[model samples]
Each structure stands twice: as structure tokens, then as C-alpha cells.
Target: MGSMEEPSPETNYTKPLGIRFIEYIKRSNISYKTHQVIVLIVTFIAYASYHAARKTTSVVKSTLDPASDEVSLNSLPWRRRPFSWILGDGWAPFDGSDGTVLLGEIDVAFLAVYAIGMYFSGHLGDRINLRIFLTIGMVGTGVFTSLFGIGYWGSIHSFYYYLAVQMLAGLFQSTGWPSVVAVVGNWFGKKKRGLIMGIWNAHTSVGNITGSLVASALLQYGWGWSFVVPGLMIATIGLVVFLFLPVTPESVGVSEEDESDSPKKSGAEVTSPLLISSRAEVKDQPVGFIEAWKIPGVAPFALCLFFSKLVAYTFLYWLPFYISHTAIDGQYLSDAAAGNLSTLFDVGGVLGGILAGHISDRLDARAITAASFMYCAIPALFFYRSYGSISLTANVILMFITGMFVNGPYALITTAVSADLGTHSSLRGNSRALATVTAIIDGTGSVGAAIGPLLTGYISAKSWSAVFTMLMGAALIAGLLLTRLVVAEVTAKIEESRSRRGSTSRSQPAVIDV
Candidate 1:
């Protein structure tokens, strides 16, 4: 259990019937271990579905707007298309001269709505039944996602139709992150949270890889199937989430510690946290957006994520398009091959998330670990850009390394850092701000995510070198944003070391001879 105690009246009243039935069947309350397992499994499925649906658009983007890239390829003359197979001639509206710009518009529109919605979603998530809130989001996301693909079947080509559908899906997508993170934060304590969330955060890259493979596999049938399949997946997982997710221990009448104690244990107060604040209070009222931002370490991390997500999402939305356009060893890959190959980037992201989390836990310095990974990404990006065209093997190796560096900081910040700040001691162990703080940090970052792909849409059209240069710059700025926090963590570590040395010398019995 977290520092949060006594289920809010809203949560208590809204407890799902599923948990009740399970407990009834068992003839006892579910144990803590059982709760943890359920939370991990359900949330993983839930968010993974969200990503799977989101990723469909990227895999299908080249198919929809291939002309712009084709023009550039012709201009280059060196890149060859020996292994490539043509999809369709590109869809209308997007197939026009302004196609790339239109695609960018819809992408930004979707993410813009998602970014704006994240703030309110976090605010509401704290006050309502997370299970229901998340379910509605999932269902809505599925509807809009399928609707976008339905354009292909329905012969709908109006730009506004696709824009509106994507924007709506983005709104629903916004709900997944805050709700899932809050649920996980509710169930687990801070002990080795990096390692735990690191393994857990693999859901992101996993979802991306799944979506890439599925979408690529389905392209031969039609691009519409790519979106439709992922749409259904998230909705199904959403049902699983509604049935099994426990928002908090109090909701299910489990012992606060989940240690087979009474429900009235009061969850043992949290006194070990290093920071404290005058702003902390005991009320169950949700934290205001402004109040949540006031928490220490929240602002810097949020700003850093702005740039970090900029880099990661740039790759997320454009990597496949980039791969298809850029020739490897005088050869181009087909849409399907490009889509499948992009999964390798996400495969590397999985390792990055785990490695970042594990490294942060060992060092006990989130900022240091995150900033270091970001700095490393600069070289990775440079190497990938310069050498990736030489051979397929070089492209794969550099892309994997680049993905690891770019996603490592992004994954750590979103999962562990957001969770840590939400429950920071500065809040006097108040868990109410968990969702709100998460919203602010991720919302700000989503703004950057929206911007990155949008800019890439234009910049890449002129010169991909310009786009890579832009990504490298964002990485540098992202790392620089953490300068203050990294310094503080380092200073604390040095002081702690000196204190331990002093304590050791004082405790020595041989001091009597001196």
C-alpha cells in the first residue's frame, strides 16, 4: 500500500463487482501478492494496447503519403529500390503535393488534444474511480481508432474526418498513462521501484513492437486492418482492466500492508522519506494542478521530459518512414520490411527501459542516470545517421543503440520518476498528487512529443540531415535541463560517503591506543 489511507468515498462507492465476486469465490480477501500480480498484469495489458493502437498510424504513414518521400528518393539518385515492393499509389488528400504536411497536421492535432487532455485526465483520475475512467477511455479509443481505419473501407477522404477521429483517439489515449501509473503507484512501495517499473515499463516498447509486426503483417490485406486489429486489442484489454484492477488496497477491504492484518491498520505512516513540506495535509481532496507542480523535483523533471520525449517520439512516429526512404547498402526496403525492421528500435527500447531503471535503482539517483543516458544518445543518433546507409547490418546496430539511449531516459522519467515525485515526502506522503503530478510532467512532455513529429514532417522533407541535427540538439538541451538536479544528487552522494567514513573511524575500538 502507499501513503494514501482510507479509500476516498468516491472510490469506495465505485468498487468493481469483479473483485467482490473473486473474493466471494475464494471465501477470503485476495492476498497482497495476488493484488500485485493482478495490477502488473492488467495494467501492462491495458497500456500496451494503447501503444499498439497508437503505433498503427506510423506503420501505415508511408503507405498513405509515399509520394513526398518518393520525390526525395528520386532527387538523391544514389539510394536504390532493389528489394522494395510498392504498396498502393498512396491515398487521397494525403497523396497530394501537400500530403506530408496534412499527415503532420493530423499527427499534431491528435497529440495536441492528447496533450491538453492529459492535464485534466490526471486531475480527474485522482478524484474518480480509476477503473471506470480508464475503461471509458479504452472503449472510446477503440471506437475512434477503428473509425480512422474505416475511412479506407468507407471511401471517406475528407481531411477533417480523419483529423477529428485521430484527435478523439488521442483524447482517449491520454487517459491510459495516468490511470495505470496511479494504480501501480497505489499497489507498490518505493523499494526497488526502478527495477520493478523498469521491467514494467517494457510495455511501451513491447506494444510498439507488437503493433509494428501486426500492422506490417496485415498490410498485404489492407492498411485498414492494421488499425482495426490494434483497436480491438485495446478494447478487450480494457475489459480485463475493468474487471480486475484494484485502485487501492482500501477499495477491496484488504489489510493496509496486505500482510493478513485488519483493514484498520492505517497503512503504517511514512517517516523515512528525506524531504518534507509545509504544503502537506491529511485531506483526501485531490491536488490542484498548480499545487502538484509546486512539489520539489517535479518541474525540472517535467521540463527535461519535454525534450526527452521530443527525441523519443520523433523516432517513434518517423522511424519507419525514415527506414523506408533511406537506402541501406544501395537498396531500399518495402513498406512491410520497413515496418518490421522498425520493431528492432522498440526491441532496443525494451532493454533501455530495463537498463535505465536498474541503473537508477543501483545508484539511487534518477536525475544522474537519466541525464547520462540522454548525453549518450547524442553520439548514438550521430552514428546512426552517418553510418546507417552503409549496410543493413550497420543500420540495425546503430538503430538499436540509438533506440536504447533515446528511450532509456524517456521510460525512466515517465514511469519511475513520475511515480516517485507524485508520492514524494514533500507532499507529507500524500498520494493524492500522484495522478496530478504525473499529468503535468507527462502533459508537458506530450507537447514536445507533438512538436517533434510535426517539425520532422517539414524539416525532413527538405533535408533529413536537418532533422537529425534537430534531434541531436533536443537531446543536448534535454540533458542540460537536468544540470541542477544532477549536481544535487552528486553532492548528496559525496556528503553521504564522507559521513559514513567519519562514523566508521569514531566507532573503532583501536582509537584508545592513539
Candidate 2:
């Protein structure tokens, strides 16, 4: 019905049918606050759908290639049980001896493609109508995801077919994060960004929990249902998004009311729209990917996220399979039980993201908050590995705690921190770098995410303890990478406190003489 890219502030793009209808009904009564609410709701569900699709493979892993026995160190060899809850023989090709390796290959392939695609997606998102870009990505993702499930019905055992579908799905999935984050950044200011984005970022965990529950519940009917349902859900939501998603404040003729919206310096020739009270300049072009990365804090945060996302994504892709294979109090869980149980981790992640974001906002120091969370994760990982199998209750508690600590920094880095950097003061007044900056940081992290699962797939076969060790080490590295940034934040705070005290003493008019 329309072109892909929205026209600039100098020109008006035709509004979507849904938006045109909305404006006609509300007319001048519509307020900026109302638009903010709409933006949050739409973006939240949109990204959540993306995560729902991403989490399906994890839940379906044990079903695709059930093993004959438990690999836990505590279990007696004779006490072993079959891995699959429903599929006795498991799916062919994947059921072979090399099945585990094949699954790992699929994980790496999908993640690698996703990581590569992220860089390009960000660059493209800035220049296009974010709504259209996001819609095409979601629909394409749905198509590929459903195709993976359709293989089971078609009785297709070709490993290459599944691999191809997953790789394509990953590429489409890359379009989601940069698009949603940029949209949200465009609407809200940086004043309460930490708390707001932290709460908003829960979409990731919410999506995960939804995927796990839906995929797990549907597993008994068929493994194929897991992927197909989430696939359909995201595609449907994508259409809703296309109809209603306003890409910018100007899109809806509203103004941002925060200081961050004003330009600190000048760069772009155009001024913010009269309807939108922003500091932004209408740049003739979007920021280049490499130029966005050159912003002061971008590289370090990107590197830090590399390790942070590694630890988080490891649990995301493997926790269900790990739970199904390991015994809790000498009893192994069914595939469904494990899949359902894994939701607790994401439940905890929801808290962690909100907590981390709130803390960062309150402290006004993103680095310190993120680093602290990463450091705490080391102990949580150790405790979970050492004591989680003692009982189901213990496992749940430890898993939730581990998830909280592990995902806290990851959520922070990807959300509020990315937004802050994208709109860095150095950008002058240019507001076009949000998607690019988000892509650079997250794309780097996606590489680590891919490596973690691939490594876990192999390491778990030899010894699960070793996998925990790797995760702990990664968490440590993540925290350590932020050392310089954390130190700088601390130093700045100390100097500010001293300066405030000095000013107070001067204003007291000779307290010592009194």
C-alpha cells in the first residue's frame, strides 16, 4: 500500500490506514502522553513475539534427539532413562549418533547469520520506515519458523533443509532489536530511561517465558507445534505493528518533553519538527556503522556485552535440555517439566532487568550497575551448579538467582545503555544513530551468544560441570571488561560530591568563625 521508508520532516509520508483512522476519531484531543503509551505497548508486544520464536528451538531440543540415558555424574549408569517425553524413537537424522553435533551446528549457523545480519539491519533501519522494516522481518521470520515445523509433517529428514530454514529465520530475527529500540528511543527521553527501558526490556524475558510455556505445552501433541504456534503469533503481531506503530514523534505530531531531546551541539542542518520539541537536527543522512562505533563508550560496552550475552544465552539455549538430562534428587524430569521449569529463569530475568535499569538510572552510572551485576553472577553460577540438583525447590531458587545475576547486565547493556550511546552528546543533534549503535553492541553480543550454545552442546556431552565452569569464567570476564568504565564513573561521582560539599561550605558564610 505504501513505500518502505518514511519521508523526512521536510516532507510528510502518508500515514497508514490504521493511524489515519485513529487521528480522524481522536482529532486534536490526542496528547503526547497517549502516544507514549501506545509506543510502549506496541513495541513491547512486537519484541516479545521475536523472543517467543527465538526460544522455540531450545524447548524442542530434547525432543528432536532424545538420548538413551542420563549423563549426570551423581546418577548410577543403571538408573538412566530415555530423554524424550513423547517421541520414543526421536526424529530421524537428528536421532543419529551425530545428532548432538548437528544441533550445535544449527545453533551456531543461526546465531552467526543473526549476528551478521544485525549490523546491516541497524544501518537499514535508520534509513527506512522502521515499521515496514520490522514488519517484513517478522513475517519472514514467521515463514521460516513454520517451515522448520512443516519438515516434520512432510517427513523430511534432510539436515540441510532444517539448517537452511533456521539460518534464514536468524537473518529476519536480526531486524527486531534495532527497530524496536530505535522506536522506543524516539518516543521517550533519557530522564527515567533506566527504569523505563529496564521495565520495557522485560519483553525479552516475557517472550522467553511465553515461548517456553507454549512450546512445552504443545510438545505432547507434536514437536512441530512448538515452532509453528510461535511463528504464527509473531507474524500476526507484525501485521498489527504495521497498522499502528508510529516510528517517531513526528510521525504522530507529538513533542518530547525532556532535556535530552534538545541538541547539545549542532550538526544536522534541519531543526526538530514544531510538533515535536526535540534537540534533534534533521540530518541529510544516517550515521555510518563505523562512525557510530567510534563514539567514546561504544567499543568497550560492545566487548563487555560479548561476554555478558554469552553467559545469558548459554542458559537460554541449553537450560531446558540440561534440566531434562540431569537428575534432581535422583529423579530426571520429563522434557515438558524441564521446559516449563526453565520459565523461572526468565521470570527472574524480568526482575533483574527492571532492577538493573532502576539502579542504573538512580545512580546515573550504567557501567557500575552492569559491572556489579556481572560480578554477582559468578557466585550465582557456582551455587547453581554445585547445589541446584539437591532438590527441585533448590534448583528453582538457584536457577532463578543465577538467571537474575546473569541476565541483569545483559539486559542493561542492550537496553538503556545502548540508547544513551546511540544519542551520545558527540552526535551533536543527529538522532539517526540509535539503530546503528544498538546493532553494533548487540551484534557483537550475538556472536558470543552463538559461541556459548555451540560450546555447551559439545561440553555438556563430556561433563556438565565443565559447562558451568565456562559460564562462570565468561561472567567474570564480562565484569572485568567494564573495569575502566566503572572506575571512571566512580571517580566522577567522588569529584562531584566533593564539589557539592565545597559549594555548600562557601555558601555557609564562615561556619568555623561561628
Candidate 3:
């Protein structure tokens, strides 16, 4: 009765859902841990949003006619049949110099920039604010992505217009992985990293699935709208990331003293003057960028990623076109039907990513997981080509399996592998090197991402048979690169044992697999 007029706890509960959530979070386990987990989930959604934006363009290609250089509404393939996609009137089914070429150019533009940008993006994330950097990237990507759709609505028939947008989007999009990988590497420890990264990687599949569904829905209105809708969605999610993403565990409440004690970093340095309550103490101050050539196995990893992406993206950028080419009863189907059927690959792709991540987590052998996918892709691609000729049903089944194996490595490498390398023990026990490591891996992969479509585009221009062969070859090459990783692992283990027995001493530390 003599207490001052203080508001009751119930009075504070009137805040909005998000505020309430924040407050509720504050009361739970150290805010630092809960905040990061929450932020991570949102970041995952943001990544998914990027895919949603990306998928829209591919799905709508079935309706748009870029081949004839016509954005004319009258020329739009509105008939809504199984496979009547016009792809901007670039080329007829299986015709050289058609949509395949144009799609390839678009892919090359994006991949080239993405690969190059990723190198710098990772280094930059280490020095700059990761959350801010990621936000900017997401926003820029959203703008360019949305512009692709708006161009169609404005009767912009210029293929270059779309190509420009692809380049910009690709550049900005590369920022996401490095930043996320760096942050995640900081949040989690070496223990169970493979499994955690694997589960986290499922976001890729989820994003692809969401992108497909959203794009398909918007394509019903018009192909351009598909781009516009997903673009807006990505932009919105990016804004959310900017607001909610926690850069490190310290922000919410994880004591730096505790984290500093972990083997990844040093406990004695927890109270260093460089440390702060509000910010993360990046392990290596003023980190220098390492050229791809300097990192051991980086070159091979890049080559591997390139080939893997070549096959993976060939499925991503051209599956609709491939499906459109499928002969039904020895007759070519329409574009709409073909485009719809191609989505089965994406559907299966989701499962493949999740399954691959789960399995790799258990095996703890990243090399074998990727190599297995590479090997499986060979037979799957063979059956895909042969079965497509037999019946549409066969084509659908084969495409799904093909996509599953093709994309499995894609998820493994980009997510799990990057995390593994970024957290590799060779960093002189510096976790801050994560951004640099991520950049190196992704930058190398970008080479493959760029080449995959260009190769497919060239092959499609020559013969569809050639395209399948190229994809198969890329898969084989990727598998071979992973073989090198396995070899390196064995070599390192032997070195470790010899050093313990004083048989051999290593001056240059070995890159420990996390």
C-alpha cells in the first residue's frame, strides 16, 4: 500500500507481438544466445527470399518471349498450355541461337560478377559491420530483381535490360553467404559444426521451393509480375534482417569471457581493450585478404564448385527449357506444359539439399558426401536424357532424381563445406578468418557458377545432347576435386601422427578439417 506508483508486469505486456517477443526473450536464457538463434531464423528467411526472387524469373520465362525480341503483350504465350513458354521469342524449341543462348548470357553475367564480388565481399565483411553489409546487399538485390519484372510491365523488350539486372542482383547476392557464414561461424563452435551447418543449409531448399511457388503464382498474372512480387518480398525481408539480425552473441548477453575461453578463440583475451559489450571482437584485427592461389585446396575447391554449379545451375536456369524440349509420343510439347514440369526438379531439389545436409552431418566426411553426389549425377543425367525421349512421365521422374543428386552437392558445398573451411583449424586459432575463408570458397565456386550456364548455353545452341554431356562432365570434374580433399585429409592425419612421435615436424601448420 505504501509502494510508489510502479506499473505492473501485466501493463508491459501490451506491446506488439515483436516487442513482446523481445521482452520475453530478455527474460529467458541469456539474451545473447536466444537473440542469435532468432536472428538466424530470420536470416534464413532472408536467404529464402532471395531464392523466391530468383525463381520467379525462371518460372516466368515460360510465358515471356525474349527470343523474338518482343515484349509485346499480344505475343505473350497466354494460352496456358502444358509447355508454351515463349522465353521472349529468342529461339524455337531446340533451335540454336534461341532462348538458351540468351539465358546463358544472363547467367554468365550474374555468375561472373558474383564470383568476383564474393572474393571482396568476405574480406569486407570481416572489417565492416556484417549486418549492415548484408542489409545493403539484400536491398540492392531486391531493387534490381524487382526491376527485372517492372521492365516487362513497361514493355521493355531489351534483353540487355534483364541482363543488366541479373548482373547487379548477382553481385549483391554474393554478399549474403560470406556475411552469414562468418556470423554463423562465430556463433557456433567446431563441435557439431557439420551437422549444424547442414541443418542450417536446408534454408536453400526452402527458399527454392518458396521461390518456385511464389513465382508460379505471380506468373498467372503476368511474367513481369512474378519478378516484381518476389523482388518486393526480398526487399521486405532484407529490411527485417537489418532490424533484427544480431551480429554476435555478445549483443544479447553471452559473456565474452565465456566465449573467449573456447579453443576457437582464447579465454585470456576476453577482457581485451578491443572487446566491447555492443560489438564483436573480430579475432584478427585489420584482416588482410588472401588470394585464392595462396590457400591450399582452394583452387581445387573452386574448380569443384564451378563444375558442381555448372550442373546445378544448368538445372536451375534451363530446366524449364529442357522440359519444353521433351518430346511427348515423339512430338514436342508446348512451352507452358514444359515449364510446369521443370518445377519437379526444384521440388526434388529441396529434399535433396535437406537430405544431403542431414547425412553429411552424420558422416562428418564432406569430401565423400560431395563426391557421392557427383558420381550419382552421371547415371541420373544419362537416364534423364533417355527417359525424356520415352514418355513425359519418365521425363518428370528422371528430372526429379537428376535434380536431387545435382543439387545435393550444391547445398553441401555452398553451406556445409564453406562453413567447414571458414572454421578450418589452420587459421592460427583465429575465428575471424571465417569471412576470408568463406569468400575464398564461394569466389572459387563462382567460377563454376559462371561457366555452367555458359557451357550449357553453348551446348544447347549446338545440340541438346551436347548440353547433357557437358553437365555430366562437370559433375565428374566436381567429384574429382573432392577426391583431392579426401587425399589431403589422409595426408594431414599422417602428418599429425608423425609429429606426435617426433618423426616429422611441420613448420607451416596443417589446415584442420572442422
User: Per-residue lDDT for 1-514 in model 3, tens only?
Assistant: 4323333454333222453455555553333455557756976787778667666655554355343212111112223422345333322321234664565456567778888989888888877878778889888988998898787658676677778888899889888888887777677665566556656766766787787778766654566667777888888887787666766654443444443455335533345444442233345453467532355655666678878877876676566656555576688766556656766886677667767777776665677777888899999999888776787778878888988898877777777677666655555445556677778777877687666666665577678888888888878888987787877666766777787777444555688899
**lDDT tens per residue, model 1, 283-327:** 366778888988889999999999999998888767877888889
Q: What are the Cα lDDT values of the candidates?
A: 0.83, 0.83, 0.68
| TM-score versus the correct structure, for each prediction | 0.86, 0.86, 0.75
Q: Candidate 1 versus the native: TM-score?
A: 0.86
RMSD of each: 5.5, 5.9, 8.6
Worst 10 residues of 1 by lDDT: 73-82
Worst 10 residues of 2 by lDDT: 71-80
Badly placed stretches (over 4 Å) of model 3 are 1-21, 24-33, 60-107, 149-166, 215-224, 255-282, 291-293, 328-334, 391-397, 490-514
